[model samples]
Target: MIKNYRMVLEYDGSRYDGWQKQGNTEQTIQGKIEQVLERMTGQAVEVHGSGRTDAGVHALAQVANFHMDGKMASKEIQEYLNQYLPEDIRVITLEPAKERFHSRLNAQEKTYLYRIEMGERKQVFERKYIYGLYKSLNVEAMERASAYLTGEHDFKSFCSNRKMKKSTVRVLKEIEFEQQGSRLLIRYTGNGFLYNMVRIITGTLIEVGLGQRKAEDMKGILEAKDRNQAGFTAPPEGLFLEQVRYNV
Candidate 1:
């Protein structure tokens, strides 16, 4: 009998193509996990994720589900998968999930973090995970700008040009900007996000920080509902899928 299980995953996306499996692409987090599953169970398995993160984007807590015929405990599967998976990808934990539990459908909230380094000298060790901007940023201005993004809004202006079937409306529960030493962190938690929403928001916040845009301009941008009204999409390297929350 096939049993459904949920797994928590973490990966350093620097070397990954992305989280989803594309035709003929072997360098994705999903493909890698599927390969390991096939090896362990000797059967094909389809893993469903909460969402697909873009290439070069890291994840601290990504949730996925799959069905398998194995009888091994969740802990055993976790240990075995970690041993075979590449260093960049790790299976953090596993749990038995209801057969009807769908990772994407069950997810209630997601939090993302974008890291920027505001300084002349970039840390060599952390360059792979952060975006370095030499210009001084106005954190106070960015914070005020971010506040405009909180609450329900039509975020079409912040989304990418890619076609999406779902509604563009989203509820942003929290948006904050903080500076720790040389790193600037932009954190956001929302019920859901449109394609490239976080990246675009980060870009707009950067523009506000640079004094090129005013905090009040965000209202006009959202009202415009045009993608061009928002700032450029921030780099994927600085973005992370921080957490996924699900209703039990």
Candidate 2:
């Protein structure tokens, strides 16, 4: 009998290429997990993730599902995977799922976080996780710009994939900004996101904070639907796939 399993994962993606399995010898979070599953089950297995995070990105919680013919307990599988996986990758939960459940297809909402450290002092320990900026950002300006991004819109300007064929229209449920001393955190929740959407939006907001772009330019950028008309894409190190929500 085939058993379907749902898994919650947490990983530090600094060393991996990305979430998706790629060409030969390219290390990825999916590739690593699939390899370990194959070793444990003695059968080839595919782990489907909720989203494809870019290189250098991290995750607090990511969901995936896989089907295999096995009799192992879910808790046992979780422990088994953790024993063989790398130090940076951890299995937080493993449980059986309904037959038709899918990690990506069934997802209802996803939250992404971008962190910027503004200070002259270098963050040595957090260098792999935070985007360090030397200048202070105008928090009020960034907040104003974020308001324009919270709604359904064609996000072609914010996406990095120029050859995208899918619909760029997506509903942004929330866009929040918080500051604690030198640390600036930007949170985005949406029904779905295009390639590099959060990163590009962060860059654009930073530009507004720096006075390089007016806050009202966000509206024009969205209307333009051209990637070149938007601001730069922020570094991947600052991004984290914070959470994924689904209706059971």
Candidate 3:
């Protein structure tokens, strides 16, 4: 009997090439997990992630699933995988999932966080994870600009034009910015996001904060729906997939 298992994972993306398995290259998070599973079960297995995090993007709770004929207890499977997998990747939770549950398709909501440090002194320990900016930003203007980004809208202006598989209309549920001295944290909760959406949004807001653009300009950018209308995409290291919510 084939049994499906769900896993909640956390990983530091500094040394890995995102979550998807690339052709034969073992540097990806998915590739590392698949290799360890293949070695443990002595059969080729595939793991599906909730979503693809770009290279250098971190994850706090990435969901994934795999099916196997061998029936092992959830604890045993978790322990076995963790024992062999690299130190950076960790399986935080494991359990049986409904046979039809898909990590990506069944997801209801996703949360992402972008970290920025604005000061003369670089964040010594968090230099790799957070973005460092030297200039002071007008936080109130950025917050005013964020209000325009909420609600359902075509976000093509904020997404990468490289390759898009579906419609760019997405519901941006909420955007919150928290400030603590020289550190700023931007959190996004949404139904879905297009390629490079969060990063682009951050860049546009930063432009507003810099007095380069007015807060009301966000409406024009959204209406334009042209990638060229948006600001630059932020660095990958500042992004983190915080959670994936499911109905089940």
Structure candidate 2, residue pairs in collision: none
Task: State the lDDT of candidate 2 residue by residue for 39-103, as single tens digits.
Answer: 99898999999999998899999999999875999999999999999999999999999999999
Candidate 1, residues 139-205, lDDT tens digits: the string is 9999999888899999999999547667899999999777898789989999998888999999999
Best by TM-score: 2
Better of 2 and 3 by lDDT: 2
TM-score of 2: 0.98
In model 2, which regions exceed 4 Å deviation? none
Give the higher-lDDT candidate: 1 or 2: 2
Q: Which regions of candidate 1 are displaced past 4 Å?
A: none
Kindly provide the TM-score of model 3 when superposed on the true structure, using C-alpha atoms.
0.96
Consecutive 10-residue window with the lowest summed lDDT within model 3: 158-167
Candidate 1: RMSD to truth: 1.2
